[model samples]
Structures are given as structure tokens and as C-alpha cells.
Target chain A: MSTPVQAPEAGQATAPRRLGRGTLRFLLPPKVIAGFAVVGPMEGKGPMAGYMDTTLEDTYYGERCWERTESKMLKEAVQQAIARAGLSEQDVDVALTTDLLNQCVGSSFAMRSVQVPHVGIFCACAGFASGLALAASLVDGGFARAAVVGASSHHDAAERQYRFPTELGIQRPPTAQWTVTGAGAVVVTGGDAAGPMQITHATLGQVRDMGLKDPYDMGSAMVPAAAETLVRHLQETGRRVEDYDWVLTGDLGRVGSRILIDWLKERHGIDIDGRHSDCGAMMYDASEQDVHAGGSGLGASACVVSGYLFKAMGRGLVNRVLLIGTGSLHSPTTHFQGESIPVVAHAVCLERPGTR
Target chain B: MSTPVQAPEAGQATAPRRLGRGTLRFLLPPKVIAGFAVVGPMEGKGPMAGYMDTTLEDTYYGERCWERTESKMLKEAVQQAIARAGLSEQDVDVALTTDLLNQCVGSSFAMRSVQVPHVGIFCACAGFASGLALAASLVDGGFARAAVVGASSHHDAAERQYRFPTELGIQRPPTAQWTVTGAGAVVVTGGDAAGPMQITHATLGQVRDMGLKDPYDMGSAMVPAAAETLVRHLQETGRRVEDYDWVLTGDLGRVGSRILIDWLKERHGIDIDGRHSDCGAMMYDASEQDVHAGGSGLGASACVVSGYLFKAMGRGLVNRVLLIGTGSLHSPTTHFQGESIPVVAHAVCLERPGTR
Candidate 1:
């Protein structure tokens, strides 16, 4: 969509300016040339009983007992993906990686260890999908031969940044999801391949401000934006909500997922039915895992790109997937703007070979 | 370059591997597609003095203060460059931007304000040139039609993060130069244009650990890397130091500049003669300005891309220009290792239409 233009000056202070309609055109389309997933042994560890099941707790030795460092996980994931693609570092024209951290430390530090030139990206949870979209655009524009998109999360590290120490008796929110400590990587190139999935299109949602105050409660904060972007993607691509084998939203826990579904149906007349799934929910067995919700930015990103999604592709259980990432655009300034929190989102459509 | 591999027994420990020469062949040559430079208001009216001079005191805010936030500066610079290239935001398939901040907050935050999907890059002072190199590779590989590259810095914000406030009487070495608080942006695309300059090739230098420990003193810390990259570019590209009408290093204050010249002559067997210059030196009056060295990452980036280099192009003072950016790759881990500092550099060659 083209950016709206400001209305012509009427020279009247009392009249409001009319908003111009934005233009929509495809400059680049999304496509997946390769994919990779990596998991660390430490990520599977469970938290202490009775502690907030949704948050990772720091243990002795300055490390989180329940989660691994996202940077380490991401490096492994990206390396494996690169190796699997039978492409050397030099074959990668660009790299887009992101994670939940103060400044995408995971992506930045990971790039340092790789030989390929890279750039770090961040859009909160939506960052991974956005990275994929951007990478696909580069490939479509003929700017990159192969690009890698990766994301990771470390539960222990993220908890400390969002909440108090484990010792602090903070009330747990039902909507809160435990961050899965994992990483996922994907390699995208031009031309046809044996891979089952290909990206068809992508759409980025405008930043929307909806008053969500708590930084830790991201599910509630990002749901609205997620819905907005998903609808926009379907609209822009002329696709229907039921066209995909599965519709996935990154990191939206049970509560946020419900909210998103309801909003989509009510506002956009799009009912996703049971085909809609949440990556966070699928990352772990909630009943056995004790996670109230499922996961966070890194968790959702890693799980969706690596876990069931890719596995399904391999087994041919799913032919097409629509992946949407939601992000909270909260900053010190936006926080100071009162209780409202702003959010951004992006969506990418992937189709299996031989699928219409 | 291809990564070196050594066969070893299953039980044998492997030694550190070096990059193989064959790997270098994969990198496509870089070309300059579009460039822009802007000089912020500089009038000795703010908190400090020595306005417009590269040699201002480390704490001088007046002469070098950027009128807008670092984020705004990057966005505007990038927007203008893309517009000047007669391309819309969608034309940029990949966007790369960098800064000197620890977290790359400037680039990250600035990207949030733009409609273009982008990734944040970090290479310290060498970021500007490195960005160009990456952009060119993307274009050459046919992954993107055009890419946007930008770098920005803010003295007030950076100072607080690096050391004690100016109020603290911290001793500084003579080799230190003040960082310029500004930004510069360029748009690089494929296809021929009426512009006089074209990017020829770009080369990146290895990150060298020079064992320099002082972060406050960047000039001395970055000279070796700059010299190494410059020499390597000349050797690899089969271009003599005198081939270009001008050879500009982003920012190597007075002291570092002298050291660089001496080092180049001693190690590379090439003397640039009077053709060599530094953007830091050109930003302001050297002696009168309090900046012992001219500027660091931001200063050099802003001054060259915006102030002097672009002006030179406009005035037709020089048809061909070779710009080199030198960066210190220092981290907390290196500090613990008792390593002084490591530096990495990148070089970009630009030529007028008829020169090459």
C-alpha cells in the first residue's frame, strides 16, 4: 500500500484535512528456498514447582536454570540451516535475524560468529516474519541469491528483563506465556526447489496504538496488531481466510489467540475455523509443561519456523501455511504517552509444491 | 573467501582455521548507485563550542550538535537519497543502516519510523562503507533492485554511554577525536544513471585484534585496521593508491592520519602523496577546533558522506573518490582477555562516468 498523502492546505484553521487512500502494489513477494531448526538441551528444562510457570527463573552461576541463551541457540540453528542448504557462507547475500532482547543482542552477536555479512533486525515477536518478508523481497528484487532468516529466545534471559527476580512474588497473568528457549533459521533463494513451501506474498501492518501498559504482558498488547496485519495480508493478496491449510500467529498465547480470532471474525468477516493455531501453544505440552499460555517472541518464532510447521512440511501434512508475527512497538516515549501501547505486525504466505 | 578446512583424526583437536583464498571469488564487485550528504546546523550556540570544526573538544556540543534526533537524521537522509534517485520507498529491496551505539539503538529506532523494511548493521566507524559493500553485493546477486545505506550518531547520547560525563575530570589521550553528532545516507541501485559517480568495488578487512584497550581514544585504536584495509583493497583491485583523484578515510584524526600514512608507506609500499585526506580534518578548522582528532564513527561518517565528499562531487572538484571506513571491534569479552582492541575496515571505490 502506498503511504497516504496529506490533504491540500485549505488555509482554514477550522477544517480537518482529509486522509488520502494509500496505494497497494507488490514490489516483492515472499518465497522460501531453505529452512533450518535447532534446539538446545537446556530449553526443555522445567521451572521450579509453584513458581510462576510462565516465566524463567535465574539460577546460581548467573544463568537461567530453565532456559538457554538465545544467541547460542540461534547460531547453531543458522549454522545447521546453512550447512543443510549445501551453501557456504559466501553464498548468502544477506541475513536477517532477530530475537527478544534489549537491542537484538542475539542476532547481532550471532552475526559476528558467521562469515557472511549480515544485518540485525527487530520488531519484537513480529521481527522474524518481518525478516523473512524482507529477505523474500530482496530475493524477488534480485538483490540476494540466498538469504537466511533466523530468530531465537532464551526464557531465563528474557524473564529478568521483563519482571523482577524469581524471589519476588509477582502475580502471574493467565495470558502470560513462557518463552521457549530455542532458535529457528531459514535459507531463501530464487528459482524452484524440492522444498514443499514457497512464499507467495507478504504484507506489513501499520503501527497501531492500543493502550496496553505492562511490558511483560505482550499477548494482550500484540493481539490487535496481529489481527490487523493478517486481515491486511489476506485483503492485499486476494486470499480468503480459509485458503491455507493452517493459519499461524507467532507467540500469541491462548488468551491472545482467542482475542485475535474473535476480532478477525467480527471486524473483517474472516472466520479461520479450527485451522488457526498458535505457535506458542504448540511449542510444549501445556498440561505437562505448567505453562499457563505457551511462549513469547523467541518461543513463537522458533517454534513456528522450526517445530511442527517444518515437520508437517516434511511429512506432507500441510500444503500451505500463513505465518503472522505480532510485535509491541512500545518505547519509553510511547510508554510515556499514557496507558496505550503501540504495536506492529507482518504476515507471509507459504505454499507447498503443486498447491493452487 | 572459502573457509579453510583441515582433515584430522576423529580424536584429534582442531586448530583455528583461516579463510581460504578461493572464498573471496564469490563476492561480487560493488558499485555506487546513489549517495547523499547533509551538514547539520553548526554555529557554536549550544552547550559547547568549536562549531563546524572537526577538532573540537571531546565534550563540545555547540559546533557539532545535530539539530534532530539521530533517528530523524537517518530517516531524512535516507528518504532524501532515495527520492533523489527517483525511486519510491518500495524500490529499496533491502535497507541497511548502522551507528556507533552499543546496541545500535539509533539505527533500530530510526528504522521504526520509516515505511521501508530494513535491517540494522554494526561495524563501528567502518559501518558506512561496510553498508555500501553489503548493498552492492545484494544488487550484484540480483536479490534487490536498490538498497539504502545509512549511518548516524549523537554526541550527547554516546558520551553518556562511553565514559564519565564531561563534568568528570577524566584524563584523555592526545589521539582522541570527538564524535560528530550527525547522520548520512545513500541509495545504491542497479542500472545506469546520469550521475557522475559509479561505485566500482568494495573490500572488507579482517577484524584485527591490535591490543588497544582505550575506548575513549579511537584514532589510535583504528589506524592499523584502516591502513590494512586500504592497502588490501588497492592490492586486490589492482588499483594504485594514486589511481583515484582522492582517497578519503572516514575519520582518522590528525594523529591517526599521520600514523596511517606512515604505516601505509611502510607496509604497502604505496604512498598516497597529497591525494589522501580525512573527513574528520575537513569538517572544521583542525587547530582551532578542540577535537584533538577530528571525529570517530559518526563524525567521519557524517562529515564525509554529507559535508565534504558530496560537496566535492557537486562542485566537480574530484571525479573519482575512494572512501575507507575504519572501526574498532572492541567488546567486553575482548577486554577480559586483556586484548587492547581489534579493528575492522571496509573500502568503497567511486568514480565519475568518464574516469574509469
Candidate 2:
């Protein structure tokens, strides 16, 4: 193997001269004219009763877990979002999508059926926020007139790839949340109309290695990184906890959510009491939802924000929201390294101009 | 499990209202400010002998493959493009990236190491043009001021996933091209600058099944899709075959290239003989570069265009260029369905205003 080479220092010789900026710059920004969400059919439904179940038998790719079941959920979510935004497929200039599949199977395949110009994205669970940031930037930059950001996840599919099969009787940790098999999408356009909220500012956190292991415990793995990024975003954008009516994270589950709240108070001296919640926790309503934790990348938070919260926003139940997504930076190596998992986070603040 | 509920129609009743026009909008159009390319250490000197060596180690992760190895090369190419663009990481509003990894491991992980706001994307091999289209739209929609589009592919990594391990002596078909383990990135920004050309328009093709079985034979799997999208783009934009100085596809190896050309002529009657080329064919000298069929995804076309062609444009070697990325819509199920592989294509046109 070639000797490990060092990445060039900022402004150093041998470094690409223009790579000095530590952050992305925006020439234009997207106005969130409207957004929509679709909750997956799996929510409220019991564990996908295995391939033997009648529903599973029908949807399964001939009884294979790798089949494209998630595509259906994704398409539904996107269609709902587009409709909510009062836009047609023809009006969408770009489709920015991401998912948990290895090569973005959900988004790519979903777009195949939708027939929209698409650019699939992947950032683990953090993809939703990252995609939103990009779409907003694209709209702000004048590169597109309108765009869509979407993501999805399926428990049966994720379990097969990341853990033991359901029939194997593997013990899932209390912190491990069932991967929600659902999809959520939002439409960002340049011109304004009545919508839930306008995306004010988006801040991205750098990937940091806090040295956590165990990809299964994504909440614990991601909390520190999520905390760091959320704090940094508030600082960089010159916003404070009080500014947002609600501060939300994608899928921190019950365990991660508590840890995050504590971290915010102790580390950042921020208090997020009633104003803070989690998509993971809200998706199934702790009691009704069997997912021990709350939500994860696929469609957990996406459905809540787009379906429940967005609907609420449209009805004038809520006015402003700050959505942050957390992702674990663990790869097969990180798992093999016995090293602590690194994590990343991104935040997008949304507000309605004339809402309460 | 819930039974498969019928999906709502596009304009079905009870659907959410769409956002009307005249809403607040942001538009930032991207201009090709500059571009560059750089061959990384893995290019000629590495554990793998030259770029054709079947074995390579992943930079971020261990265990070598053509995919990860090529990703490192694409990273260097992107660095060069950023340098040529005369922009820093901070200048980039969003770093839009994609690759062929099941989880987009190369692009997402590599992006964490970079300082830009990373948004990893995927569309299989079609990622290059898809990214360009999205980036350009971001610029045109006023979402970002400047952005970068990147893609990469590796032989070692891809081979292990698609076919027998290098350790296993396996016969391969000539139609199968070794995935080029390389990376390429391009910087797109708003406003004018000295560069090859401005991106005029981008169009995407629908995914269609042509009943291709072997995942290795991507050329045949993708040719039809490429033809359909390219023709549609031309017709929609009201441009004829000779409008572009050059029209290129991502990686249609010799066999697929011929097929695509023939199909285009037969189907669209728009002759693009000398004007058309493939990134897969151009990346290496046929004899010297053991890439039998051509490159796929990853940095295949992006690297070539940004590194080689962008540089040529800077030196006044060329003026206008049209890049098209083709992707194979082959899922594990396409094989099961006894279906032919469907293909999809996306295209972006770039040109120097004054010179052209």
C-alpha cells in the first residue's frame, strides 16, 4: 500500500490552493414555501411479522429482504410532499434524496418511478438535514427553482444488514430502536406561498470522533456529536435556544433524547425543557409504539416532521421549529477498530412569517 | 402488517394543497469559474500495481477494492477542480457528492474529512451528471452561491462486491469493464469567471428495464437508458445533435458506446458520431489501461471531465462540452423478475460563452 500521506494543511504547499475555507458558502438560499410528509404504513403496525406473514409475503421481493419495499414508502412520501407544496413533478427542478441502503436504493429507485431529475444522497441518519441544507442552498444559489429532500428506512431491511435476522432471536439493547420502515419528503421552492415555515438558516457540524463503539446504540453513539454540532450551529448562526419554538432531533429515541437534553444543559448551558422533543419518541407514542427507542434515519423523524408536525404547522398549531439530525460515523472499520464511533449533526431552523 | 393501501393519485381529493407561485424565492445560477484534476498516489504507485491492479486498500477503511481506491483518486481530482476554480472550502455553499458504494461509504466518509458542508449523493453511475444537474439547479434556483459535484469508482472494491473475490480464480466477460478506482470533483459557483463553459441545461431519463442479468455487464444494462434520456433532453431543450461541441457519456465501454450510438441514430435520428465519447473509454489508453469495458460511477466521468477536460478547457484546448451520465437500473430483483436491466441517463451541457 502507498505510505499514508498527510492531508495538506490549510494554505500549505502541495495543497489545492483554494481548499482553505473550513465551511461551505452560500450564494443563494431556498425559501421553504411549503413542505409535506407521509407517515409509513409500518408505524402503529407490529413488527413486520416476517416473510411468512401475508403482508410480508406480498411485499417481499419474492421473500428476499433486499427487495425494494422501501421504494413504495418513499414514493408515497414524496408524492405527498409535492402535493402539499402545490407543485407538480414538472415544477420540481431537482430531487435531492438519501436513504440507509448501501447505494441509496430507496431514493434512487424511488426517483426512477417518479421520473424527476434526481441526485441521491447518503449521510446515514443525518442525510435528511444535510439534504435540506443542500436543497436550500441550491435554491438560494439560483441553481434550481424548486427541489425536494427525502429519506426512508425499513426495520426488516436494516436488521438483515446490520444485525441478526428476526428469526435468529438476537437480543436488541434497550437503546437500540427498531429501524422505522417509512419515508418522508419536503419541497423547497424559491417563491413564497402559505407554508408551514421558512427555512431561516442551516448549520452543519463537522464529523468528530468522540470514540464510541457499537453502531447499534446509535443514540449513545450520536449524542455527543449531535450536541457539539447543535451548539456550534446556535453559536455560528447567532441564535439561541429561546429563538425556536421547538428544538427537535431526528431519531434520538428515549435514551439518546434524555442524554442530549442533559448534555445541552450541562455542556452548553442551554435549557430545552418543553420546547425539545424527538422524532423517534414521537413517532409511535412511547406506549403504543413498540420501538424501544424512537426513530432512526429511514422515515422515523421524516414522517413526524412532515406528517404530524407539518400538518400541525399548517393548521397554525405551531409556528417555528428547529430540526436537527444526528448521524453515527461508524463504518465496518470503526466497528472493527473497537474504536469509539464518531458522529455528525446538522440543524435547519424553520419559521412561518405571520404565524403565532 | 397493513395491507397494501392504494396510493393517492397525483391530484386526488384529500391531497394537501400545493404551494402557489409568487412565493418568496432564491435563485443562484452557477457559472464554471474554473476546474482542475490531480492523480493521487494510488494512481501509479500503490499496493495495486498502477490503476489496473485488481487489489487496492481503502484509504479511510482497510481492505482494498477498485471502488474505494478510485474514490481517493476522485478526491484529489476534486481538490484540483476547487483549486482551478479559485475557491476555498468556505466558498463552496454545498459539497454535493455521490459514489457507487452500497451505502455511499466512499463519498460520505471522504466528505467528512473535507472542510466543506458535505451533502453526499448517489445515482449509481448516473451520479456524475445527476450531481451536475442538481448543483447547477441549486445555482439557478438561488439556493447556493457555489457548489461542487464529485463522483468516483474503484475496481478492487467493486469486483469483490459484484463478482468473485480476487482470491478466487474466476472467468470474466469481455463486456465487463473494470470499474475505474478514481475520484473527480467540480466546483460550480454563481457569477462569471474564466473556465471551460457555463452549464446550460440538464435533463434526466426514466429508468427502463431491458432484461439484463449480469450486474457486471453495466454497458448493456445502461445503454438504452442513456439513449432515452439524451434524446429526451435534446428534444425538451429544443437543441439538435450538432448543437454541442462534444457530447459525452459517463462510461459506455466500447461495446456499450457502439450500442448507444446506434440506438440514438435509430431512435432519435440525431447523428452524434465524432461528437460523442465515453468517459470509460477516454480514461485510459485501451492497451495500457486494462479497463476492458470502461469506468463506472465513482469518479469515472467526473474525474475525467474535471481533471483532464477542464484543464484542457482552461488552456484553450476546447470550448463547449456536454456531459451525460448513464446508470443501470439493476436491482437484485430485476434478475429475479426475469427482466432486462433498465437504464437511466442524465445530461448537463457546458460551454464557453465568448469563445464558443
Candidate 3:
């Protein structure tokens, strides 16, 4: 299903060039050799079902509990990604992973048996995007020959931790997005590899708080950060909306997606109306899925990119792609303390090997 | 008290060469220009009190809650570290931060006002070591000329989340370590910078589970991981224990340190008795402080390195040091689920630029 990228000889060195204002231009771009996604039954019935590598018969995935299930799904995604890339555990040097679970136990436990050097990262749902930037940096800098990045989230596991328990069957407001029960992994290698997808540029994001405190309304809280990063990436990279075939966001959902378009147009004088599509908004059939706002969780972006987007890219459906992963950086503790939510977004530019 | 490191011209590119196994040898190493530690009043009376930049009279640090106080301390540490380096926040390209808090609110909320690009990392207490490696990779690879890495933890905040509430005055087992109420930050720059401390190499650690499930006995659970990383680092770098002035382990505390010494001797046929110390074990005067096993939090390593160790390094007390940050990756939920503790350790080799 995927062609493996060639790795540089052991002890090789690569360089990364810092570009205008917070942007990094990898001199030897990192190649995305393979991606795999494992999702729950509901997600398998969604729009991108065909692209899913594995759809569990039950949420437990045969595990004893939801947390264990989430961990198992992440591990499966990673192993499948490596296998799909024609690589093995030994070929992978590092694994950068995270999930919405407290202390990032989902990724930690998942990577426990993978035997790859692991680094846990957390930026709420934006973890996958941050993981990509770091993994690409490692590969591009020759710190690692191949790096695997993954993120996972189980709806039940996340609900009990962030909100009320699923057993309570508490009502969710219209502003609340449904946490996706899925996991995704991607294999990134050095520029020497022969892969269709290449990460050429990245932009690091700053935390931006707009004084929004409603935990249910995370989309609104995260919109400013998304806009900030997208604008920064475009300006720093000297690119325009027309320069890319698509501008994909992580999981801003319906309300946040609308806010993003209007915010970009009003604040940055840039319009992405036609170019923009959100992973969250596209995850499910809005009318049929019964997801209030849209699909969320780190898994939302993870599953969408690893399953739908990468497959589309392989088929030449989209070439130059700018993916911005946005996150709401607030804990229930902070929300209870009446503090405003802080948010962040990271942008990575992936392109077809020979494309503009 | 410190000198600012010189940064290369914008767009400069540097290379990082891969070493044996899991180590990365930086062609141009990153220099630690400055470090700052902030602690609560209880920590102020500890052995390293003199080294602390600020010791708050109260745990809240004038904040309304323990969580906010932790965030404030992290931000203050970052600001003070940059200032001590004779740089401003604008000069820092990135901030890699994490804490014991769920979702890493301590670092994220702290970075909210700093305006620097933020990357949240979590490896329990090993986050600072991971952050240092990533920060060094960015600087060495020229992705960022200047990056600041910080970790923070508040004892009260952590107790309520990881265990029982402080108000309960729960009796801790003798093997359990006291969480540190502190924060630390360090500014890292490209090798062009003339600084006293240089990070020459780094070794990423893999997760290791030894099937030890007792949350109170984290030291025993983490020992195997510490030994694993330490051995890998030595074998990869071709360095013996005698090569380093000190082999520091992050927050192994008393029990874990003892276990590490024995584990290394038995498993790896290496001994680190005379050259070893633990940040957790050394954080307080055990007899006087009544801190059970010892100080154990992300802040334990952060405070020690930024305060005691760095000061000692500056004074030529230690030249070449290999600091291994250790973490036991287990949450209350994992414990409740009957899972063994998974642990990880990351090592960074720091040296006085001219030293052997």
C-alpha cells in the first residue's frame, strides 16, 4: 500500500534553516512514507471509512477498559504505519506521541512495548501537528533516520477525564464537539527517501488567550491561535492562499471553522473561504452522525490526516497542503478556577515531491 | 552572573550527526547561557535555597490557586533565565515546557504571557530532559537560534491530582517521595555562543516497564528505565563512568538511586557509585525536611539543575556531567486499571566547553 523511503547512511548529518519569523525551512525535507489509522465503529461508518486501516468491532478493541483500548489502538496505528512503510521497529529511531489523556498515559502506555525511543508531547488535540514538526526536525536534522509520530483519543476515556463520566449520560451542549475514538500514526524519514509526501516548512505557534472560559466552547477559544499561526506561516513562507491547493485545520468544527474564516478575513485581510476545510468538520456526516458541533479530540485530526488526507494526497487529489493543528490549552482545573482558556496552533506544509 | 551566547546569522544551518544506537552528536552543540529557579517558601529553606532566584513567602505566589501559582513560577523562571542571559523574550525563538499537571497546564498557561512559540512535552518528571534534547536539536540544527526550556511543579497542585488532596493530610509511605514546589528554566543557544555550559550530546530513552505496580514505590518502578538509558548512553558515546565528573539522575530519590546503582552493576556490568547523585535525593536535607523518600517532581530536577548543579558547574565543581532525567509513566486511572508502571529516562551530556 505504501513505498518505503530510503534512509541516509548511519552517522549522516542534515541541516535545517531558520526562516522568517518562527518558520523553519528544512534543507533536507522529511518524507512521509506511510500513515495508518485505527478508529471505532462509529468513525468507520463515517465519510472516511474506506481509508481507515482498522475499525474495531467494539470500543474496547478487546481490552478490559477504554483507556487500555485507546492505548492498544495507538500501538496498532504505529505498528501498522511502520509495516506499511516497509520498515520495522529497529528501523525507527524515535517515536513522538501524545493524547488527550492526563499525563499523556495513552501514548506512554502505547509506546511502552514499541521499543522505540519515546518522547511524549501534549498540546491537547494539536499534539499530532506538534509531533509532526518535532519528528520532521529530528529526521531533517539527521538526529533520527526514521521517526514515528502518533496521537490517540478514546471518547469514553476522554469524557471521564475532561468532563463527566460516559455512564452518567450527561447532556452535551451544541457547542461541544464529539471526541473522536481513533488513533493515527505516520512514518517520517529523511529527504533521501522516495515518498510522495514531503514536509518542507513549519511554523511554531504562540499561546493566545482571547479571554474565553467556556470549556464546552473550545472552538471559539482556539480560533485566535489558528488564525495567528496560519497568518504567520503564510507571511513568513511568502505564500498566498492561492499558492496551496488546500488549507486544512485540525478540529475547529463548525462554529470555529466559521470563526476562523471570518477572523482571517477581518484581522489579517486574508480570505480562505474556498481553500479551507477542517478535519473536525469533515469527519462525520453532520446530519446523520449526531455529533453536535463536529468531531474533536486529538484523534479527530490524527484519523483525518492519516486516513483521508494522506490517501487523497497519494492519489494526487491535493498536492501543496498547509495543515494547521489548533488546540485549546486549558484543563478542567483551570476552568474550575475561573481562568480563561489559552490556545495554540502549529502549522506544517506538506507537498508532493515534484509539485509546486 | 551570566554571559549571552552569540547567535549565527539568520538562516544559518547546522548539522547533527547520528551516533551509535540512540544518541545524537551535535556538530555545533547548544550552549546553556543562563538558568533560573523559583521555589516556594518551604523550598527556600532547603539546602539549595541560596541558589534559588526567587523564593516565594507563600505557595500561591500571590495567585488565587496552587495551579496558577505553578504557572506563574514557570513564567517567572523563563523571564529570569532570559534576563540573566542578557536577552529578552523577543530573542527567544521557542519555549519547550511541561509539568506534572494534567495536559501540562503549568507550562502552557505560563507561556501564555511569554509570547514565545510553545511546545508542550510530558514524560512525567523526565520532561525537562526531553525538552533539553529537543531544544538543543533546534539550536544545533539551526531551527532556532535561541530556545528556552522549562519545567514546573507545585506540590499541592500535584498531590490533589496524582494522589489525595493536601487538605486530607494523607500519610505517605516512607518510599513515596515528596513533590517539589518549584520551577526552573534554562536558555539554550547555538554553539557560536560563548557560554560556560554546552550540551554536547543527547540520548533518547525508550519506555521500560518492570511490572512494578505500587504507585508509592515509583523509585523501584523507574530504576530499570534509568539503568537502561544510562547504559545505552555510555555504550553509544563510548564513555565510561569515569569520563564524566558526575553522573546525575533526575529524581530517583533515595530508593530509586540505590536501585539504579545496583541495577547498573548487575545488568550492565557497570558501576556508578562514587560518581552518582540524584536531583531528587539532593533537593532537601532528608533528616531535617521530613520529605519521606525525597523530593520528586518535575521541579525536583528542574530546580536542582537550574540552581544547585548549574551553580556548581559554573564554579568548576563539576565539568563534564551526564544528567539522566527519569520518569514513571503512570496515572491514577492506570493504577486503578491494574497496569504496571511504565517508566522512561533521557540523558543529556553537558560540559564546560573547554573541558575533557
- Choose the strongest candidate by TM-score: 3
DockQ of each: 0.10, 0.20, 0.69
RMSD of each: 11.3, 11.3, 4.2
RMSD over all Cα atoms, model 1: 11.3
> Model 2 chain A — which ten-residue stretch has the worst lDDT?
A48-57
* Candidate 3, residue B38: how far the Cα is off, in Å: 0.5
Q: TM-score of A-chain in each prediction?
A: 0.82, 0.83, 0.95
Better TM-score candidate (1, 3)? 3
What docking grade applies to model 1? incorrect
lDDT of each model, Cα atoms only?
0.61, 0.63, 0.87
On DockQ, the stronger of 1 and 3 is: 3
Residue A230 CA displacement from its true place in model 1, Å: 3.7
The best candidate in terms of DockQ: 3
TM-score of each: 0.73, 0.81, 0.96
Which regions of candidate 3 deviate over 4 angstroms? A1-16, B1-16
Local error of candidate 3 at residue B108 (angstroms): 1.1
lDDT tens readout by residue for model 3, A166-264: 999999899899899999999999888877788988898998898999888899889999998988888887788777878889889998999999999
- The residue pairs found clashing in candidate 3 are B6-B193
Model 1 lDDT per residue over A140-191, tens place: 5444567788887766666655455556657677767777666788887763
Q: What C-alpha lDDT, on a 0 to 100 scale, does residue B303 get in candidate 1?
A: 43
